[model samples]
Target: MRKLSCLLTGLMLTAVPGVCMAQMTADTRLGVGHSVTDADLRAYFSIPPSGKGLPAGSGTALQGETVFTESCAACHGEQLQGNMAPGIGADKLIGGRGSLATNNPVKTTESYWPYATTLFDYVKRAMPFNAPGSLTDDQVYSVVAYILAQGKIIKADETLDATTLPKVKMPNRDGFIADPRPELSLYR
Candidate 1:
């Protein structure tokens, strides 16, 4: 028993150093020292504020009504009034024209969004919640047209394309001002 114990001890001590060195060598080889190019980090989807990323298509409010009825009405409500769950299920897309200063403000596209481009970008990125980026460019344009029509910002017959979308002035066009903090006034 004593001889066996000595043999086992001798074997363990001999094996330990080799194992430790092998582990260290492996770890060094797997160290975090890699480079990623711009292409690797590029965004798969993005929309600029100038409707720069809008695709080549056009649609009208008349077309959008069909798309909205088919794809969006279930979650966003029949009139885009918003559904309330444990949290707000969906955002109301209309009927907040002059309610920003009030306690119960309704911040819909008509009342809040300064740029039509922002609307196009947002709808293109994450909408229909369940099936994002699923709408064709024409469908997206139509939906925007429909929402704009509902908001009373545009006529139902107006066409919405990349060229015309950016020109649609929202009511709150001048609502936002560039941050002017840390100026001469602040120093005083």
Candidate 2:
């Protein structure tokens, strides 16, 4: 009787995963989650450096400061010094200007990033450390504006949107050389 029970439990354990996988791969439904749709893909699409895919909303540095305090300060630090926690080491967002040429260069946002648009793209795609892609476009824009303002990269009053964001040049704007390789020409 004991041998029979052990054999049944082992078979059940092995069979459960297969059944779940089968359900997950089925065309109709997974019984647990709905299939991804085109709209969902569009929601998570990348915003290129040209600001081509940036949403219509806009935000200011003041508004961004509030949003940052609520969503980003825990991981990135209240002053953007970066969290010192073991696994949650968020990067410092401000300063580090003119250090790129030095041996101990501190690559903060103001000093390292080549384009402000890329900042917007990164924040939109992955941020808040815990819940990525959860912030609305306005919230993302506000946080970006705040960070840039803190770094002195842009005026605190400067409003960032699709048109203006791509124009806000970074301190290292001219530092990056264009890729000379032919295979990567399409990206240029």
User: Top model by lDDT, which number?
Assistant: 2
Please provide the root mean square deviation of candidate 2 (C-alpha atoms, Å): 12.1
**Which residue pairs overlap in candidate 1's backbone?**
none
Error of 2 at 70 (Å): 0.8
Best by TM-score: 2
Cα error of candidate 2 at position 125, Å:
1.0
lDDT per residue (tens digit) for residues 1-188 in model 1: 33443344434533543232112222346685334232222224355667765678999998999999898787777797877654437888988877887898889998899888888878876777888878888999999999999989999899999899998999888877787676758631
The C-alpha TM-scores of every prediction are 0.70, 0.75
Among all windows of ten consecutive residues in candidate 1, which has the lowest summed lDDT? 17-26
Tell me how candidate 1 scores on lDDT: 0.76
Tell me how far the alpha carbon of residue 158 in candidate 2 is from the true structure, in angstroms, after superposition: 1.7
On the 0 to 100 scale, the lDDT of residue 178 in model 1 is 85
Question: How many clashes show up in model 2?
Answer: 0
Give per-residue CA lDDT, model 2, range 52-101, as digits (tens).
76788898899999999999998889999988788877878898898899
- Candidate 2 is scored at a TM of 0.75
